[model samples]
Target chain A: MIAGIPISKNSYQALVLSVLGIALVLIMLLSLSLGAYAIPFSSVLAILGEQFGLSLEGVDRSAANVLLQIRLPRIIITLLIGGGLGIAGAALQGLFRNPLVEPGLIGVSSGSALFAVVFIVLVPGLVSGSLIQNLGMPLFAFLGGLTHVWAVYQLARTQGRTDTATLILAGVAINALAGALIGLTLFFADDSALRSFTFWSLGDLGASSWGKFPVAIALIGIPSIMLMLEYRNLNALSLGEREAFHMGISVQRVKIKTLILSALIVGVGVSLAGMIGFVGLVVPHLIRIGFGANHRLVLPASFLLGAILLNVADLMARTVVSPAELPIGVLTALIGAPFFIYLIFKLNKINS
Target chain B: MLQAEDIHFCIRQRPIVKKASISVNPGEILAVLGPNGAGKSTLFKILAGEISCTRGQVDYNGQNLKALKTHQLASVRAVMPQHSTVSFPFTAREVVELGLPKDSKRNSERNIREVMELTKVVHLEDRLYQQLSGGEKQRVQLARVLIQIWEKKPFPRYLLLDEPTSSLDISQQHIVLDILKKLKSQNIGVLIVLHDLNLAAHYADRIAIVKDGLIAGFGKVEEVYSETLLSEVFDHPIRLVRDQETQQILVSSNSKFHSDLKISKQAQA
Candidate 1:
């Protein structure tokens, strides 16, 4: 009888994930420490410790408040949006069985952005009132995102099978239509509203607050974990739909649930931070190439790596021209586009 | 132990399987032989419960197959379809490991290695499945499905293979057939669809010849491979010759041999 050969792949993946998790935590703290009123690293640590019942003395109360109240929420939101986008992208890629597929490719981000612009332009009174009074934008954005994807799915289904090319084409068409409507709405907006809409669409973490963290966590975190748990099914699906069904997966049901989960995460992230791009498209592919295509590893690693990348990008956005703050979306595209192009070239070479 | 009773199937208002019925005992190897568009794959799909039959039912061990959940059916049978493609570069071992049930007693890594060795794919274990040649991919896929149904305790496992050896060379074909024979000796039922009638004749306990979505003839090899049936089903004359020493049948198409047989028949009459 032959004994089992030692397998290092799973262990290697676990180690990589552990290292990334630690790095992400450190980056999150580092992001919290750098700003116009730069808090000392010691002061940031003291404030964090105090929050966790460490009882550190001589920490400046105002600095503590700034770190705890303002910077902490923004940093947390950055991580949430980043991690959410990454996992959502990975899940979408796996569900669609195409590396080029991303959350935005399915029209979720554009659909959400269009509805968000509509809320800001046509219903300014509701948004301009107060933070508490402006709940309609996120709600409408989520609803619009879900509705558009459902419509695309329906349009793509024919004779009990969903053709991937048709689905992607329909998503592209919907995204174009949504873009046109957004442009029309923007053209009619007042100056202040235009600025807000532009900043929102370009993606920012300015609206981060403790009040909204629970909603983000509930919407993004739970679904991301659930998608990760379905890793085996996703692996089977990568082989193709019929093969997955033969392996006992309900392929149609998995596809629908995966799409919904991805849309929910993308919708919530966009509603909070406003249409951040490239993290979803790039992070998952990078992780798959680095750690192999097992979702059990790829999903979590993508989430952590995404959070770290976005947090670092957010840090760059804030400090590059300090006190003015470039949009986070701009930083991502500036960095991500070249890398995406390089990946396409690499993929083509491999295929050839 | 596996039975498809009067199964019928259609796609888009066109019948693909026309009331086809077949059964395989626990230790038998059943081969389905057909031309293009003869519903061999459709029959395999129905037998594996991958698709529902439009009429009739499939029963395994007195239990209705339709009543079982997809996972439940998967635990008992493994099906490998033609044209397995991957968009991502899943490693060969990882692809094979996907077939093993999560709750198996033996270590999954051990089972994966064993199956790969059985299918002679151990050398390709670390390579990406997509980078391999067509024959290598087929072998890896075969190992995957084999690992899927390889239980420690004896259970009636069934393998439904659709042209599994087409990409393989002659040596690998015999190796695959040898594996199926070993499985049959262990009371595993094997149902394979083949375009090569010679391979089917050599390996199958029974041959089912299908034409136009229905069975033209199905029985022991000698009964099903008659020249008259082959001519009618394939729309071409076939000559069946026997080895003088081994008495095994060989199918051929030689006009001169047919003419000589006609002359000999005239002389005997």
Candidate 2:
């Protein structure tokens, strides 16, 4: 009534979010229906029903297995990984109070990639026969992500304050160090291991399995909820640290919690998909610009928007060359870079 | 009442606020007026509990200021610094809403509208805060601080402003000072640091002249604005004249002993 708009503010936000969520779901279903062995939409839904113990008619066994065992996991993994990256990006941007700050901008991706490479290259023989090898890559990647962010946190903190400039500087230094270490690991890798590491670093959601779903859920879901709970606090923080303190927020505690939550989300995302970029940075910015700066709406919108972007990017990655897939990371960065440059110029023009 | 006893502060081992002592009673408007580098902002920071005093105690309403949690301090006092920059664009209404409690008694939209209107920023409510001009941003910030201090019932509220109207034009400066004067009628303790001497003389019930990180003088406005005190504190001459029609003090020209002084003596005779 005040703004003379058609819908209530909260309803408008909810409507937009629902539409995005439905679009993401539809894109995922479409993703499952595509592939070299194109399955029909009906068959895809049937396989989904079968997996959930619902009796569905005319569901072919081979098609069901392919949809359930392969396409379904890949799609789910893409959604989870993309959503996690988006939330992480939003949280980090809020924490740093800068739209330019992304999870990867602070070296979490490279740190995780370096450790993932180490795990793959040094223990190729162990992964060949070990059941735990299924968990090894993600576990090591998570640990690496945790370690890098912790170092960045420590470096950014001075007298109980996290200076954004210092944090960015530390991230640059750590990213370079991690990059060098990853290169060293690549030199000793055998041909097969090298290829695997290369693909992992470039990032792919091609290795999704039912066994990995629980891990992804635990890693992404927990932190996502935690970050969402901190939404109000993050909104206060956008007013700046001093104002946030005046609003009765524990500024130090909130910063640490946000950083840790972001780290966890980034770790889970990198473990699942190697090192996807741009989703976390671009999705949150897009949401903030479209909506307002309220994190209550921004965070959830970011999650849905992120899922859609990644799914669409994955769709492009898999279908562009057909059978010989382009890495999802390459597609995201290729698209994200130009868009990011355009955004910068647009912002500059607006300022001028 | 707000009290600071022997507050000592240093930045990088250089003393900024050295053993400063002051107190403000309820319904009082205390102005801290000083020249550049007088550490008025630092003193305000100490009172707001933004920084810890090296060797002093700040007591607010019988509770130790340092002991109270950040949220508790926020509930009691609202501080507006000289400059604020938000990296992202937020609507003016949204910015004002940040000051209210999450479960505020009044409707958030209505309250935002009230504060924006009071600050004469009602039309700018939908405008992006960052896109607004500097004076507009200052007014929005004033609205934010006012909403922060406003509550359902009358309680002892502390409003701390640091050069709030520095970015505003002459007319806007009067608008902000008038708002501060109105707050005094509501029995709120208003503490403001102002560079304009005449504004402080007109609006502030008491003036605390700070010099070299210390209170050079603190008393009634008339007592603090004497020629000797003004010249000594500023290290420059300022002529103070009283208007016969309005009986208001006007400061003009920077002369140590001018024609205005002779006029002041003649008017007293």
Give candidate 2 regions above 4 Å deviation.
A1-4, A51-54, A125-136, A153-169, A350-352, B105-107
- Model 2 docking category: medium
Q: After superposition, how far is residue B90 of candidate 2 from its true place, in Å?
A: 1.0
lDDT per residue as tens, model 2, A188-225: 88898987776777887887778778878887877887
Candidate 1 lDDT for residue B150? 75
* lDDT over C-alpha atoms for residue A305 of model 2: 88
Candidate 1 stretches with Cα past 4 Å from truth are: A1-10, A125-136, A157-162, A187-192, B153-155, B243-247, B253-269
Clashing pairs in 2: A248-B71
Local distance difference test, candidate 2: 0.83
Question: Docking category for candidate 1?
Answer: medium
lDDT tens string, model 2, B176-216? 88877777756578899999998888888899999999999
lDDT of 1 by residue, A237-318 (tens): 8888878877888888898888778887888788788988889999999898877898888889999999999999999988
DockQ of 2: 0.67
Question: In candidate 2, how many clashes are counted?
Answer: 1
| Candidate 2: RMSD to truth | 2.4
lDDT of the structure predicted as candidate 1 = 0.83
